[model samples]
Target: MELSVVVVNYNVRYFLEQCLVSVFAAIKGIEGEVWVVDNASTDGSVEMVKLKFPQVKLISNQTNLGFSKANNQAIKLAKGRYTLLLNPDTVVQEDTFRECINFMDTHPDAGGLTVKMIDGKGRYLPESKRGFPSPWASFCKIFGLTSLFPKSKLFAHYYLGHLDKNATHEIEIMPGAFMFLRSEVLKQVGLLDEQFFMYGEDIDLSYRILQHGYKNYYYPKCQIIHYKGESTKKGSLNYVIVFYKAMILFAQKHFSKQKQNHFVTMIKLAVAIRATASIIKRLIIKVWLPVTDFALMFLGAYLLIPWWEQFRHGVTNIYPRDILYALIGFYLLTWIMSLWLYGAYDKPQNLKSGAKGILYGTIAILVVYSILPQNFRFSRAIILILSAWSSLSITLNRILASTFIEGLLKWNARKKSVCFIGTASELKGSEELLIQAGFHRNNITHLLPEEVLDEHQRAKKEIIADAIKYKNISEIIFGTEGIPMTSIIHAMMYLSEFDIDFKIALHGGDSIVGSSSVEAQGELYTLEVIPLAKPVARRQKRIFDILSSALIIVLFPILWIFLVKPLMVFKSALQVFKGEKTWIGYNHPNISKQNSVLKPSVYLYSKWGKGLTSTVGLDFYYAQHFSITLEVSELIRNIFKTQD
Candidate 1:
């Protein structure tokens, strides 16, 4: 065979289908063969390939063996003079293969090549060509100097930004997304280093191609659209750590003896920086806005006292900031805890979540105030004023922070003007679903499939540009059957100049869904996180349940006489020991297993043992928003809000 195409896929079946369709079209006249090596994807990618493209060779691994190893499996058996490692989340232009082959054929010294690439939004991806990550180049990139001076030779070498996109050039790196290499070159340079689980293996392979006397070229004659982050999200902490660790592996292998320490140090610093940024982002989104509520509550509590004294006792001896300040802090902390337990501060906030969170907080304050000694108590007049101020401030902050996030940057906001793009038929109930999912109903608009593909590329670009300018569409949703990946990619490329977000709506016929999660179809939205089923996470919950339940049994002595005997506490504990029940879990244990916020299915809650006394729908709430921090918050609530 003249050409062999190798695709490594992990759970992106829809994108893989579109990619194969484009690949089949690209390799038309040539003696070409395709190999798809699936990395044990549960997204039905293996089944799709077997059913739809059986002509292609398929290798199915039982577990994720990393990107390098998966590609090596297919590369070892490839029979073509040239092998192309293509990402599943990409659409190749019709001329991509032919142009690459012709260029390689003409350049007798070309060992490997990569064509120009664009992201889903259609802008040229700088990773299409790159210089080796020497210490200096890595530093510039890690510190973001490369982005600051894209066209400058000194700072922009990471992307080889010195080169023009319109011209072919001898570059140092070709992305794994579109690595077209000579079969003979593999015999000389060896395969991708399996030590790299995902990130730096491409850089390692590219450097080896150069070390072995083969030249790598960046050809811009044809392009493919890379639907970036479909396989792995760049925003994830795991991705960040793994990526930087890959850099360290590269530095150890390739850096000079004298400069190895420098490169290693740079890699470590980069990892630290990325990890810190990820943590800060999570803290701001999850805790920062809620903290403001606490601060305002304290302020309201302090100010209301003087206002009450002036009216009731006609004594304006203003209390010192220290007077009952500690108690006020404790009381407000309980209220905020109540907010967290009541499912307040959930992302993608709906109108009611904010109101309910504040309501819970107010009730908590009232409960605490009613039980306080005279020395600790503030007057009822002060309590009412504090409640009003705290409720209004917290509610307004939640609304403005979520909806007008960009304008204020005061809180974590995801308010977006969404453009639903699909065929008119496919879009029938999409609008209603999106509204229920908490997108602004008024901000939601439609962009038909015809408008994106009715004309040529130039015309499509014009139409999309005009729409983004006039309608201010911040997010673009692709409907299944309503929009093909190719069309979605095309729209992204055409609207590349515009700042917008792209998402694939998984509108499957599955009936499972959470409050704002997957139900009928599953949307693989951009950077959408899928919870990994780790047995350790479940074990932690078991440990916590066992410890907390034992403590409660011992501490609450009255429970031993009246409640423990009648309610069969020992029997429940036996069931828990036998794995039939959990100390804390869903309202029902034997229900269907669910794992996503998108559907109401057992998703996250099903992992734990069920509890004897459930706290409202907290199990289901945690099921929607799973995190160590949120888990701790739920545990705290279970301690205070117990029912026999």
Candidate 2:
């Protein structure tokens, strides 16, 4: 065989489907065999492969075998002269395989080859041509010197950034996303080291290939799109730890004793620093808005307290210091908590939720005001004024942040401008998919093949340029069915200068996948609607949980006379209240464990039957059509049957 393509997939079913589509297209007439090693993907990746690509060699692992072990599994079974370790999140061009094979055939000394890779956004990934991560290179990369001096040979040696990206060059390392290796080289040097689990296996193997007097080439002619970090989250502390730890393992396996120790220590230090930074960054992103909102609201209310005392009582500091501070603090806490529960901070630039949350909080504050002692009571008009201030201030804050801030808080409140490039049928299909995926369809523009192609059927650059100028298109989506992989690659390369987010829509699939940057996780917009995935639905469900749990706790005392296990009922309520469990959740442990959005339940049942399968069905039904009434009815039906 000419080539054997091995893709190790885990839970990225949609991406895997698109990747396989491209792979099959690329190897249309070639002597190539494809293998997919699915590492216990609960997202139906195995089933999808079985149904769609029956010709593929499939190995379904019962558990998640890390990157190295999984790739090794397929490499051992590969029969082709060349073995390509392909990521499930990547899309290869039609001429990619042919061009790569030709190159490998000509360059007999080439042990491995990797091509130029652009991210989902069509941004050239610098790691496509990297120097071997020596101590100085690693240090430069870890300490941000590589990024600071990107084109410098001394500091940017990690990525070999001074090298031209459009030309083929001999490189020391190949990215795991698209590593094309000669079968002979693999047989001589051995399969990927299972010790360096995820990140550094490519570096280790590349270094070994070099040591064995073979060259690794970075061929830029055959470009592919890598929607990076689909299988794993890149923005997590675990990613930092795993990546650096893999580097340390590589050091232990390959480096000399003194260099190994030095590398290990440096890696550990880098891990500690990066992990800590990740944690802090995450914490800031999570709480920055809420904290800022609280602080501003508190300041407004605090200032209002002194003004109210002066204006109404004709005396400054009339209220007691303890009561004054305590009341203000309590009121602010109540408002913030209510806003949080109502999901004001959930959606970016969603001022409507914040306004709704403020209104609800005002009502709550009034309710609490009526119940409090006369001495603790403050001005009702002051509360009204403070609420108005909060509403205005919060809205202004969001508008300013979204306008000025570059990342995280920067969100376009306006409908996104999308341009779909494909056939008429694919354009219509993509529109429907976009609507199902919750994209605004108002500003959508369709660029048909005929409109975008010349008399010779060559893609016209001015077509996209005109669309961007006229429509202010921010996102461009290409359909694989209507456009060839070669055309997609050409479009991406030509339009790389534009500020457009590029997404790929699989011809017959429900998902549109993209990533804004190389460091970002791949974003999938699919038709598989989980009701609980909505912020509003989640907020309502949480409200239902809290109110129902509180009522259950309150009624437990009265039910003690008729109940067989009154204490158990009380305990369940407590658990639900504390978020340790849920009143109505997924019945099956497996479904519940994999992004089910429901906590483990105190009771499991359905209107259908008492069987285990029935219970699991009920869970799916609940997730799809989650409503307060459904949960309440379920709670009522299964309240007495809790022991079951």
Candidate 3:
């Protein structure tokens, strides 16, 4: 046997399928066998492998065995001269295997090799070539000296930034996304250390290869698209802890005690710094709009209060000092909280939502005024005028921020001018899928191939370049029907400098997969609908839960008369208030809770004597089309069945 490709897969079902499609295409004529060790993926990955790629050797683990242990399981069974550890989120070119094999055959002392890798966006990944993480390298990396001084050998040794990316060179370490090794070298260095579970094992193995008198090469002749962090989210706090802990473990195993201590301290410091930065970033993203809105609203109300006092009563000091400030604060808080409940602060800013929320809040303020003592009843004119001012101001702010200011800032703007490159049939199929995935038809531009082309491939490349340059295309989709993986790969490589997002539409597949940037996780544009998972839907749902639960508890005296078990109703409301349960959730046995975004609930909509098959069907419908009104109606209908 010449090559054995082992891919460790997690819950990236669609990415895994596309990767396997490319893998089989790459290994078409080679004497190679493929192995996929699935780590308890619940996303139908094992089933996909079994059904789609039957020739692949499969190892279905009952639980997550982590990366190293899973790869070791496959390596022990691999029967070939070269064992290639491939990530399931990567797509290889058709000639990638042949080129790597030829290079490996020529280099007698090369124990390990890795090809150049790009992210889903077609941007070159600097992790393709890296120096060993020594104490100085770690210091440089943790403090971001590597990024600032990328080509400086002293400051940027972490990624070996001074090296030419297009040329092959011997490197100290290889990325775990694509590590090719001679089986003989594996026998000498042993398998990946199980101690370093996921992040640092590749470095540990690379260091061991060097210790065993073999060279590690970074061969740039072959390139693959590594959709980074498909198996796990890299920006998450858990990822930070696990990755740095692995680094500390490597230091402990390899360095002296003093050096290990220094490295451990630096790792801890890096973790602390990252954790702080992550928290600050999250707070800024989640709270900035609300905070800014509140500040502006408060300022507006402050100005309105003084002017209203003078204009309405012909006196500035007529109202009580304490009551005036307190009531204004209360009013502003109520209005902003109502806006949040109505999803006004949601992304793609909804002006109608803001207007609606403020209208409800004004009605609420009028109701409170009617019930309050006569002494505390301020001017109704003031309240009415403030309501109009608040609504207009909020709408104008959101309009300017989302439409004009955010455009100038280029903050999370939607991509435009989408183009698809492929055969006629594949282009049509991809267009259908793109529309089904919710992309606007008007935004997509179908730039047809030049009909008078002599050399079709070269023409296609020129078409892509012209589309990017002239049309200012923000996104490009490559269809795999008539285009070879090599053509797609070369097009991406040659046009890597353009500011465009690249996605691959598998031939006859239902999804298109890509990442917008290096830091982003692999994103798939699919027809799957989970309304409750959207940010606006989730926030509104939680607000409904809180308000409904509070209302239930407050009106318990009257509500108890309609309930079979009144205390159970009270307890369920309390549970919902504490976020222990939702008001309505899926109850079908066949419908997995993991597949839905809702929590366990006190009430179920699909429990109306439906059979086994229809129970799941109803649950699916409920999950996809859930609303606060649906929950309210269901709760009212099932008022006497609270014990269930």
Top candidate when judged by TM-score against the true structure: 2
Cα deviation at 527, candidate 1, in Å, is 16
Error of 2 at 548 (Å): 2.6
Q: Is candidate 1 or candidate 2 better by TM-score?
A: 2
Poorest 10 consecutive residues by lDDT, candidate 2: 404-413
Candidate 3: TM-score? 0.81
Q: Which pairs in model 3 have colliding backbones?
A: none
lDDT of 3 by residue, 276-382 (tens): 89888667767766777778777787788788888877878777878877877878888988888777766544456788889989888889888989888877887
Task: Please give, for residues 425-453, the per-residue lDDT of candidate 2 as tens digits.
Answer: 88787775576554677878888877777
Clashing pairs in 2: none
C-alpha RMSD values across all candidates:
8.3, 5.0, 5.2
**lDDT of model 2, residue 493:** 72
Q: Give the least accurate 10-residue stretch of model 3, judged by summed lDDT.
A: 404-413
Deviation of model 1 at 467, angstroms: 3.6
2 or 3, greater by TM-score? 2
Backbone clash tally (model 2) = 0
Instruction: Rank the models by lDDT, top first.
Output: 2, 3, 1
